[model samples]
Target: MNRDKDIYVLLTDTGTVLTKIIRTFTKDPLNHASIAFDEDLNEVYSFGRKNPSNPFFAGFVRENVRGEFFEESMCALYRCKVSQSAYSGIRAQIQHFEQYSDLYKYNLAGMLGVVLNIEWEREYAYFCSQFVATIFKRSGVSLVDKSPLLVTPGDFQTTPHLELIYHGKLHDYTGCEVTAAAAGGSFRTA
Candidate 1:
């Protein structure tokens, strides 16, 4: 991966009953976080509902923005420029989990920690934001000052180095020019 190229952070409100309940507590438009290797974001990785119809069956999910599965979701797309080494580390970590996805499980206990304002982790289990947060931290790219176990999808909105490039219906997002204003150009934060 080239440092000059853009990597994406995807936040989505999938408009499910479960997401609605999470919304009431977080009071934010986002309930999920995913990372993408390419700016086009053909495939996005995250810890989310493996079966979209059932919120409980979840682990590492590879999402498609333009697919029929996400037709009703809203999304915020962000771009960040990271060193090639950082990007490689991030991708490698994601791939590691992806390769052994069967061993991973949804962290319902971790989500309980969020409600209780406590932090906890289970072996090979993760929620959406924590999964992404861990990837960033493992890559030596700290996106938030908080602990990865305590991070939320909304927290990424305040990330100083992350550029808010697009917010719209996921179905409408072509992923080609996620940052239509900058268009193929990405900036680094000091």
Candidate 2:
């Protein structure tokens, strides 16, 4: 696959926001910058400046900016952070790459594949959840079912930091029964 076609998936609680920011950085030629809401009016954020000595900043800019004029030697340093994050043994990979130039090519090919797969999975899950919710809505059924999909104690792997109580059942079983019947499913009752 072409390097430009490769995707990077960031998996975290704020994945959506992170993905948007990354896209903005990659899609633009100018140094993308934004002011923090909490910061004073005098201060401004400046990203993407070419600096050879500072490996960290150089790497960060190269990853964010595509088709920009970056030195060939700095490409290894630019990919170092990604290599370290995706694999446990970066030192070994670097050493191997040094001994065999062909290894670097293989390493990049594998890493790009992993990144694209992760992005696709995240996108698929998000769309699937949306589709499920839409089906429930169209069937006149609430998506938030009350009969906990999870049980207590076994589900309580962590201590209760917060708690909420519903005055009534979140889902209507009667509506579900009608929908299920139409959809060719039988709900067993005791």
Candidate 3:
């Protein structure tokens, strides 16, 4: 877990009907969130749609921006440099969820909290934003004081430490400002 390095939080809109609905409700362009271990952002972890095209059947996923699902996505990148110990803790938490991903599920109910402004979280389940928030908190790098279950992709913007790195079509990204890693961590294998 490159502790001295930076961790990335990616806010995205894949332009799917579901995302459109979310944007309409939240009045925000970002509807999803994921985390990457490096600046290159080759692979990212999130609790989201398992299948690129299918919206249902979602869970903890290791997503790819260059993949068919996110090829058309609009993304905003943010980074945070954390302590080595925090990095190790974050990586360990992510790896733990990844290891038994099947035992975990997407917190579909938690999505309602965003609209209702209520806090809700299920055991062994998480939504993308909350999942990312939880990792940061568990790693001693809490993004915000808000409850992780109530966090949204837009909430990452409120975090004091998150630095904006890039914003544009994921398909069009070519490391204009931030060096898209020549190579990065790949999607995890189940």
Candidate 4:
């Protein structure tokens, strides 16, 4: 039997200048995307600012959900189930990226291509959503029927593959609590 495990998709609106610019184009409240390996989000990854204060110096990052950048961010969390082998594949892919992170860069140009409805794929470079979609695709999982280069944070919301688990302030998220509530226990939302 193939046991299943869950991977988390986190979308957020950090209210930064870059996010505001992205929000203007996408018209989506949440302009950034991340992947979390755990229900409590101890391991969250994204292609974003390397320094919290400098959006220009950006690339692969292991996000701290409790960081000042996310303290007041609005967010939506989704869960996707995958077979054990697929989970292992995803983990291996993340590890590969982590080991060679120096070779990667944030795909700012690709974000422009997204606005123009064009696909711009660069070697070792990815935007936030593109990175997440690429991870799933490379791991033999399809989150949506589209090219990873064309994937946007908003695409995740409309994809049938992901189950919406929580939507609120990132600071207010109690992952295990939310998980229990989603499993039919009572949950209080702020």
Candidate 5:
């Protein structure tokens, strides 16, 4: 029998100038979106800035949510239940992106399309929400009833399929044991 597995969608507002600008256009608290394979959010992926200090250089990234970048981020965690096969497909899709990460580029123009309510498709290019939506689409899972190109981080919250599990400072999240480490490691020096 095929059982269901839970996948996570993390929406965050990092307070960066770019996110601030996005929030203005989106009118939402969280403007960035990421997908996590586990409840602890240890394995998270997104099409976002590869370097914390540089927003221009971006693409597929295996996000370190526990790292300093997300320490003070305001975020919402959502859970989506999928069949075992769909979970495997999602895993495969993420793994494929990880393997060819260098070939991908951030879809800057697509962001404009999102703001203009148009669909923009580019080869091997994706913005955060597009990437997350594509993952579900390619995995044969229906996340939202809309085009991936036009999906916004706030759009995920409106979907009935996703359950909001937590909403607060990313570091203060105590939904799992990982929060203890996140809370403790904040002020510690390496």
Candidate 6:
């Protein structure tokens, strides 16, 4: 699909959103980790690096709302388009069905299944927001009006006016920073 259209597809997929969050760390020189939390501030999944190539690979360390945590391997790769470099192309999408969908049925096991399946494109920020919104919606938390969330780049500068959606409502959870990196992937709880 075209890059723009490919992003639209990602915005619509529940799994792709979660994957984007996980994949954000892949762009960094450090193995940065991400922590996914529930409404009650409980840990969900910890996606981080398993080994160190040089202590710079980004790692994922996430725990469930129930306080469960684990490690997994993650990588970032891109596809090519006719007019774009393969490194900057849009490829297949990803989803976290087992993480969000199965959360109601299973515990970390279900989350792990979903964590094992995060994916996204190389340089799309707007689509990344949609992905984040999808995860919040699927996780069963409603968004409050005017909620604030943070999306940071490699330099740690926050994107202005990024919309925050939660459980179908708009909420302000601004302290959270979503970083898009390049390298290994994982989740972690803080």
For candidate 1, the lDDT comes to 0.81
Tens digits of per-residue lDDT for model 2, 65-141:
11122211110000001222222232233233235432111122222332344322222111211222222233343
Q: After superposing candidate 6, which stretches have Cα over 4 Å from the reference? A: 1-31, 49-157, 161-190
Candidates 3 and 4, the one with greater lDDT: 4
The collision pairs in model 1 are: none
Residue lDDT tens for model 4, 86-188: 8999999899989999999999999999999899989889999999999999888999788999888999999998888777777667542245434443333
lDDT of 3 by residue, 122-162 (tens): 89889889899999998888798788888889988778888
Backbone clashes for every candidate come to 0, 0, 1, 0, 0, 61
Instruction: Give lDDT tens digits, candidate 1, residues 114-133.
Output: 87789988999998899988
In candidate 3, which residue pairs get closer than 3 Å at backbone N, Cα or C atoms, i.e. clash?
40-181
* Sliding window of 10 residues with minimal summed lDDT for model 4: 181-190
* lDDT at residue 127 of model 5 (Cα atoms): 97
Tens digits of per-residue lDDT, candidate 6, 1-190, equal 6541111100111123334554454343212222232223233232222232222222222322121111222221111112223212222112333334222221222223333443332222212222333333333322212121222121111222122122110011111223222121222221
Clashing pairs in 4: none
Candidate 3 Cα misplacement greater than 4 A, ranges: 1-3, 174-190
Candidate 1 contains a number of clashing pairs equal to 0
Candidate 1 stretches greater than 4 Å from native: 1-5, 175-190
Model 2 RMSD in Å is 23.7
Candidate lDDT (C-alpha), each = 0.81, 0.22, 0.81, 0.87, 0.87, 0.24
In terms of lDDT, model 6 sits at 0.24
Q: Worst lDDT window (10 residues) for model 3?
A: 181-190
lDDT of 5: 0.87
- Runs of candidate 2 with Cα error greater than 4 angstroms are 1-68, 71-89, 106-190
